[model samples]
Target: MGKVKISAVSYTNTLPFIYGLQHSPVMDAISLSLDVPSTCAHKLIQGEADLGIVPVAALPIIPHAEIVSDYCLGATGAVNSVFIYSEKPIEAIKSLRLDGQSRTSNTLARILLRHYWKNETVSLVSGGAEAYVEIGDRTFGKQHAHPYVYDLSWHWQAFTGLPFAFAVWVANKPLESSFIQAFNDALAFGLDQRDALIAELPPRIDFDYRQYLMENIDYGYNEEKKQAVALFLSLMESLEDPKAAESLAKRDLPK
Candidate 1:
């Protein structure tokens, strides 16, 4: 059998999953590449990787990607990593620069910004901050205390009263049940050894790295996660833009 080519996010939140893969039976059976969230999705869409932990927003961009596993990077509420750090309060913001991390987050930010603070016309451009949103390990504990930071997941809940899913494992094509089982077993191993995995991380990340990994992030693909993903896809489908609507409809996700 050919090696399964998997792409994962190069973020602290994904360390456990990577650690699981490293120690699992699937380790030698797979080849892995790591990239930023947006790049991970781009690589998968370009056919450079067979499976990716793709941003929920980018799922629609790929035509034949399937959910090969029931695992995801998610939070019940207030995922502490993805933040919108701003110089002023979010209500006072005019234009906001998006950290070039994940497209899913960029959309989530916009959705919340519009929903809760309806009076503020926030623009999501690629520039410096009147306010700015940053995700993953890059922003942890390095305080830019000027702008009022908003946790995207928390913001989502404030707007829609639902949990949020960030990224999910998606395969370019379907794999046999045996292979899927192997992958799940690997991930389970990784989750069980959270302390050992955190110890493996290097210093200089500028945060309470271990605590954040163990406490702040929830790495499960439970029923709530499934409902949240489905709701997000539905919202994307309902977008006024026809192109976005068609993209969501055409994504061939596994039932």
Candidate 2:
């Protein structure tokens, strides 16, 4: 068979997955292109790539999407990298800006504002809003920049009492079982080497890489997180219907 075309996130958070894919023998069987989270979703939706590590929000729209791996970009609480930064408190904020790199995080921020935070006055803007949702590496050390830095994943866990999976490895179509097992093995190897891999990355005095990777980022995909993904998707779908979201407002909350 021809090389399996893969679109993967090109962010610091995904470095380990990229590292694993490139360093292992599975690299020979696949063609990989690193892109922003939005582009990863687009490629898979358009059938430009066979598989990708995509935001959970995109799963409902991507045709024939299937979570094919046992790992994901996830967090149980206080993921330092995804936040809503505001000089004003979340309730007092009237408008918000969104990050350009990720669809899931922006959507996550909106979900929180509407459901968990109970602040519906916030208007999304392209520039100079009172608050903005930023994700990935750009959010590092940014907590101090704003008086109120709301951690979205932390909020998700607080509200749902479940771990949040931001992105998961998904295939547009089913693949051979052997290839899936090989891919899983390669990912495991990369995760095992995170300590060594992190040592090679440029150090940042502002952010604690060890704490963020080991504690904040929950890389495993288990049954509980899967349920979170399902509920998250349900809430995401509800955004199109206010009556449904009103019920969600009653139950869902944030930390």
Candidate 3:
């Protein structure tokens, strides 16, 4: 077979995986494309890519989707990158503008507002809202502009007291077990070299990039993360249309 086309997130959190993929022996056998979280999921859904490191929320909606890696983009307490920035206080905000770059963060914002914040009056608007969901590097240094800056993962941790998995590596269909093993090894190699990777990055005044990557973000796919994923998906299903959720439930995905 030809080189497997892989779509991955373009955020700094993914730098280790990118480094591993590019520097490892598997580089010769795969092609990589960098994109926002939503686009990564879209490419796999449309068959434009063979695999993707996509938002966890996108998994239930994509047919035949299967997680293919032992690593993920996650947070233990506070993920500084995902936020709900509001000019007004959280209680006063009546509507929110969803981020154009990410679906998971947007959904997370809604779920947090409805359940944790206890604000069902808030509605989603296309634009011109007092509050907005922002994710990735765009959220850096921008917290000062809003009076109420809510960190989505932090709120999730407060509500559930569990680490949250934001994104995972997935494939549309099964691949050779050997190829999967090689892919996981490459990611592991990159993860092991995080210090070297951080040293090479340019300085940012907004936040401590090194500290954020090392302390806030968690990179493994273990049983705890699996439980978090399951709970998150169930919450997402509760927020979905009844018919749609039932149809997806019939597909035999973990509940």
Give Cα-based local distance difference scores for all models. 0.79, 0.88, 0.87
Local lDDT at 73 for model 3:
95
The order by descending lDDT is 2, 3, 1
Give the candidates in order of TM-score, highest first.
2, 3, 1
Tell me the tens digit of each residue's lDDT in model 2 across 1-255: 789999998877887888888899999999999998989999999999998999998998899999999999999888889999898989889999998888888888888887778898888889888888888888888889978989999988887799899999999988999999999998888888889888988999999888887788889999999999988887887788878767766864444
Off-target runs (Cα >4 Å) in candidate 2 are 246-255
Best by TM-score: 2
- Shift of residue 255 alpha carbon in model 3, Å: 20
| Weakest ten-residue segment in model 3 by summed lDDT | 246-255
Model 2 residue-pair collision total: 1
For model 3, how big is the CA root-mean-square deviation? 3.7
What are the per-residue Cα lDDT tens digits for candidate 3 across 99-200?
988878888888788767878898889969989898988877887877789888988888877789999999997788989999999999998989999999
What is the alpha-carbon lDDT of model 1 when measured against the actual structure? 0.79
Compose the digit string of candidate 1's lDDT tens values, residues 1-255: 799889999888998899999988798889999899998899889998888899998888886978877778887677888888887778888889877777888777776665456634666677665877788876777465654778888777666666788999998877778989999888878888889977877776457766677766777888877877886766565455777656655754222
Enumerate residue pairs that collide in model 3: none
Scored against the true structure, residue 19 in model 1 reaches a CA lDDT of 91
RMSD, one per candidate, in order? 4.8, 1.9, 3.7
For model 2, what is the alpha-carbon lDDT of residue 42?
Answer: 95
